[model samples]
Target: MPPIFRAPRYLGASAIAGRGALPYLACVITHARWTSQRWFASVLIAMVVLIAVATVVGAEMLSRTTEVSNRLNDRIAPARTAVAELTAAVVGQETGVRGYVLSGEQQFLDPYAQGRGDETRLVAQLRGLLEGHSDALADLDAVERRMASWRETAAEPLVRARRSDSYNVALVTQSKEAFDDVREPLAGLDSKLAALRAEGRADLNDSRRLRNTAFAGLVVALLVLIASIAVLLRVVVLRPLNELSAEVRRVAGGDFDHRVAPRGPADLAVLAADVEAMRGKLADSLAASRQQAAELHRSNADLEQFAYVASHDLQEPLRKVASFCQMLQRRYAGQLDDRAQQYIGFAVDGATRMQQLINDLLAFSRIGRMYDDREPVDLDEVVGRVEDTLALAIEETGAEIVRPKLPTVPGDATLMTQLWQNLLGNAIKFRRPDVPPRVTVTVTEDAEKYTFAVADNGIGIDAEFADKIFVIFQRLHPRDVYSGTGIGLAICKKIVEHHGGQIRLDTSYTDGARIEFSLTK
Candidate 1:
């Protein structure tokens, strides 16, 4: 046999690998898409969650800041009023002392007492209001110090003058100068407190701006992520898989010549390569098988032609020798000696056997030439015809032919007739002398082929020669014991083989010989 061209195995493996990889890659891609979608969705959800959190936090912070600012603003005004009240009280005390000293009126003394009391209470309240803040506290301390200096240097001196009876008018002027000297410091302290409040408001505004900017950035980033994921899925997963699917459809349609173009990632590229290799190998294998079949057909035709010409040419010489030998025996048998007659008889028998061999060769060649014309042939009718032809031999041997119902097969009528004749003849010829020949013909059919069996109770062949008996010119018996052209079984083999079928023999000492053949249905 030609080296079993391991190409099919390689192609089969490649095809299997290619087909298997496609689904694997598809599963991978599907999982990737689902996972990627989930990831994108999760990121978006996380972003939204963060945005919500940030929004809530920012709103709370802004609300709190606004509330604090409003509270600060409200406190600033109250603090400013307190400072103004304290300043007014200090100024009034100075004016009252100056008036008492310069106008010599006791009524101004009441004003001084009222101013001192109010100034003391206003300074205490201002200090309480500024308690928590060092900056505000420093401003309050400056105002307090300035008021104390004004009371000591201006109010007390003017009051002393009024009590001393010297009543100097210069003292009243000196007290007014002292009040003006303290006014600048108290105003500077109030200005510093206002600046601090302004800085706090600026910080709160900056915080709100930062929160808005962060939220906007988060939204943009999430949108970009979603868009990127969509693009990735389309490019990497969906498009490549669609291409693979199209290639698979083409292959299914019997276009094994098409090659898949490599695309996508590493695994998909490998799959495409495998598919291409499979197509190449399959095409090569199919081409080789076609060439092999064509060569085999040519060989068979040549053998059949040779067999027909050779057998026809051989028959003419054998016929002349047999006819001449028989004529000599009939014309001169009495004059000839026993030895001469025996030699002449031997020539006749040899010639006759040679003629039979040539005829068997012709029949064997005809078996190969016969083609299935596919007309219905009733096998039962064929068997009956064979029985009629072999009637004399059957009666002589007392052979009993048992034929079961045989199916009608699509076959050539003449070839099937010849087939039954040869098998039935073999059955009668090889029978045991004491036991009557019992021959049985049966048939069975399956979806694709039909089997026919011809069984006989005869002197069976040895197991060793069973297969050899179907070869041309192969014989198992001596000429004296049994006579045959040795091509009968070979012809049967050829006929079965020509019909895309096979033949075999079953033999045993007790059961005799059974010939079985199968033909395509």
Candidate 2:
């Protein structure tokens, strides 16, 4: 197929896709604009980045802090180890002295020699530990001097007592007392250094805790920022877009009068201005069009009235001329030849039929010309009057008219009566000879209108001739076959239309015809 022929399908598909995608796209754009205005969104993102950076920095700081702590801890370990060794040396020295006093053995002197050697090592270790702090170094110096004096004083007495093979208890007791003095002061110095080491560990723990708290606070700030951004986007962007969409839907659904106020970002202001301009243009164009339509309607009404009056006036003269001609033909037939009489009769018949046709045209034209006054008309009563007028026709045709209960409607009573009379009479007149006319009138009511249906079992019109039947002088059958002026249905159409209603053929065939009309209730 040619692309041109496929154009309509492509256009329809494109329109459908556009309609489907527009709402989603609008929502996305609205959300994006909202996000742009969200202070918290930007803040949240920045905070997250900052928190990540801080986390790295804090981790590095923690590592360095821990290293410092470890170095401090390492310094304390050796001093503590040396203090323990010296205390053991003091105990061994005391035991050795006691052993010499009791056994007089030279093997006991071995401990005394080891103790003297350990005394020098202990002093050197203590000095190394106290190298950085003056107060701690002073305390270590005091402890060292006491240790040297006690060792010097206590060891000489013990050696002399052992060499003489006479162990002096008093001298040994004095030596033990001096050794206690040295040990007690050394233990006090060790306690002070141990307290300092504990303080350093506590500082390390505090630093680590502070770093963790900083990171946690940063994370919390980031979370709060993100939440704030989300709220801003919803209020600033989504809300305005939704309002615009609702207004647009109203406009699409034939409410072109609707207007949307500009809101949200600056971009929407331009759109709102354009929409308002379009609305104004449409309103102006509609007003001008309505004015033109009113003028045309007035001209049509004038034309109809003129035609009705002209035709009605012509009908009386034409009727009289036909009646006189017919009288002359009947009265003077004996004096004239057969051909002359026949021609006169034909002229009279043509004039009489033209008169009838003119009268029908006048009736059709006068449907709503002088009958604008509307009053409540009982359709049932109208139907009864039509039945009375058509009683002889109905009897002759053996037609049965069936009607449902009808309602009172606002319309010209005379026109409503005529409307029913013409429709019902047509049904009876257009009956098939072999079958009795079965005409039924049904009524249906709605909120604003009432529908009246007149169905017939008769010589129904062809589908092609259905609309033609309503036009003036347009006949489906010859005058000899169907006696009609051919303006009945046309009058019915005009009457219904004048009352703000419509009339149409519901169904029609050679055997039957159903006609329906509606009027405002």
Candidate 3:
């Protein structure tokens, strides 16, 4: 590598750490243009860019380190070994030549012969390994030149003289000097190879360090990214969402005037505006409903007052007319003609029927209107009172009232008694001719509620008129057939409903009419 381009070859951990995103993030977060979408998107893109850069740089560093390691293993180390082998070969040649000269034996020439071949092969191998390395090649060339000079000027001459008994001490000393020349270059060549190996290892170490620092930076950046995302969500969404939810809950808790004001984004603010508008509408509707309820309560009070006053006022005139007519019938019994007696009779009957109508009307109107009594009323006792009230009818019609031991219910005792009397009286009144009425009163229970079923074996009400029967003044039978104001079932319905119960005719009961009603425990 050129020195000019290798200025920052090994940027250390601090270089990577210094370029971290914290400073940039602080600037970005405080920017007015940094919104939720932009914050997340920019951070995500930055993260992806960081990861890609780290991956590419790490891979390049690993490849470069591997290349240098391979050079040390496959080139520099082998070249060094070749250089060492060449040096050993040179020493062997010097020793073999000296030994052959001293002993004047031809067998002593073997190592010299073998050493020349080894040295030639090693030089060629080292040249091949150090092909692109000028320093190593220059060292190899010096060693080769010196070895050739020794082979020509010392080794050959010494061996030749030993064969002829012409080798002298002066010639041996000159040959030894030539051998030192070869040894010097061999040492230089070995040192040069070692330097190359050391450089390759150093390059490998630097690459590994750079790669490690890059990956560390990536890890730190990942953590920073996660923290940034959390901050963005907390600031942009979660906190605002919590505030909005609290405002909505407050409005729902009957603080209808608490305005919903949302922050953060335009979309969220628009949604809050919609909610506030709805709250306004709801508040207006609530106020209107309260006004109507107060008006309805006053109207109901006025109607109750009118009903109480009207019944009392009308009862007096009907009673006096009825009384005077009865007196007339008794006093003029012989003097009066048949038509006159019938006229008096009609007057008395009309007055009596009018009085009965007014009484039934008063009773029906009083139900669920004036009473505030709530007590545990023994229904069995209520049924007993109803039986006594209808004793004459029950005995005349020979009706059988079968009942279980009824459970006590929370309600007005008078209202409950009236309920039973109306139901039982209807059963007895509407009995089939020549068929004794059989009324069964039974109570069934469920979780948190009781269902009381009063069934009667009599002329049952028609399915079509089942709903109409419970309406005030609604009668299915003619006036001549069923003689009473038709408000009994309506009163029973009002009583049951006032106690938070429901009363309905069981159309499924084929044997007779069954009135089913429910009361919560």
Candidate 4:
């Protein structure tokens, strides 16, 4: 409370607040560096790397297996088939040679000619197939030598002897021995080629099995990687967002007292800190608002007290002045000049009006004072009573008050009655000279409030004076034309507002003045 401390106290408080925020500020700094964006990028990069590595390994394994299978199917199997065909060709040639030697006919030599061409083609194919296998190629070369020697020594001799008419049994016996030699080497080569085919088939099966295993392993690895990424994303991103959403809902529900705690990833923590800062500002603003409201309430109470005192204490003096002026007017009317009489009349009228003004001001000031019990007051009853209170005016002006059955609402009954009385009286008082005053009071109910409209076929208030008409002492017409303290609408406004509702002129009514008000039900 000392002078020097008081001025600089706020500075110390602000320093303390800044210090309090340092932890959150540090958290924000850490959050930016360790952001969720970085986390997602890392996961994505790792996934891509894993996929690349797996793809490379799988592709390599598949390539090697495919190559082995292709070698067995395309090269080794076809080579064995070629070797078998070569053996068959040699046998066919020897059979044709024997037929020609036994029958001494040239027609039997036709098979030998065809077999010779087939034998050459088969040998060439076998050599090409065995190119990479040195052991197999050596066997193929020995078979080829035997085939050439047999063709030179047996087949050519038999065919020439049969065609020249010099073929004999002795020549036939030599051809048989040559064919026997050829058959022995051809049989050996066939056996070796069969074994190679068997080995190739076995290797092909193994290669296929290995390829299937690698493919299955690759698929499983991909599934596991996808699952891990999904779990990581849910834990690192989705769960944090869900928690932040819940905290946001709590703050929106007006629980500003409970600060949101930092949660999940660094980014979420930063968001929570920012929300907490906003909550702090809102709490401070609310506190300041409450303080200002308290000050305003006190000021209104003081003003009300002043108005009450002035109205109550000054009434007797105003009454005496009015009474003396009336007495002077009645007792010495002829003795006074016309100007003196007019001055006296002015004083009397002024005092009476002043008294009326004070009374009206007091009534206006007393609105919203919680002295009476608030209970459910039926509008039907309130309107009925207000009608009776203005029965004389209604009769004089022939005003028709068409009011429907209305709902009951909560309010001080006397105040509700006064509110209706003032509205109905004004409607009758402000009737247009050309038209007979017609008033309609209707009620509409909603869940929270009842809207009661009092419309009259009278001289309606202009749109420009709609707001001004509710102000105290604000009149649209001269006092001589429409007699009133000009506090009727203002009093109605206060009463409606005191009951936690609003009263306004319905500008949509073009035929006449329509005043609408609401009361909580």
Q: Which candidate's lDDT is highest?
A: 3
Which candidate do you rate higher for TM-score, 1 or 4? 4
What lDDT score belongs to each candidate, Candidate 1 first?
A: 0.75, 0.75, 0.81, 0.80
TM-score of each: 0.51, 0.55, 0.80, 0.75
Whose lDDT is higher: candidate 1's or candidate 3's? 3
User: Candidate 1: TM-score?
Assistant: 0.51
**Model 3 over residues 1-521: C-alpha lDDT tens digits?**
12111113465545423323223322332342344566678889988998898889889888988888888898998888887788888788888888888888787788888998998899889888888988778877887888788879888888888788788888898898887877776777778777888888898888889888888988998999889889978977788778888999999998987867535544454455567667778988999999999999999889877786768878889999999999999999999999999999999989998888888888877786666478898888888888998999999999999999988888888888888888889888888889999999888898777898888888887788889989998888888898987888998898888888899999989888999988766
- Specify the highest-TM-score model's number: 3
Residue ranges of candidate 3 with Cα displaced over 4 Å: 1-45, 68-82, 103-131, 327-336, 343-347, 372-396, 403-417, 442-449, 499-501
Each model's Cα RMSD: 13.7, 11.2, 12.5, 6.8
Q: After superposition, how far is residue 292 of candidate 1 from its true place, in Å?
A: 4.1
Q: Give a tens-digit lDDT track for model 4, residues 377-463.
A: 887898888888898887888889888898888888888888988999988999999677999988888888888899999888889
Q: Model 1 off-target regions past 4 Å? A: 1-272, 275-301, 321-340, 443-452, 500-502, 507-509, 518-521
Give the clashing pairs for model 2.
none
**Arrange candidates by TM-score, highest first: which order?**
3, 4, 2, 1
Better of 1 and 4 by lDDT: 4
Residue 112 C-alpha lDDT in model 2: 73
Worst 10 residues of 1 by lDDT: 1-10
- How does residue 387 of candidate 3 score in lDDT? 92
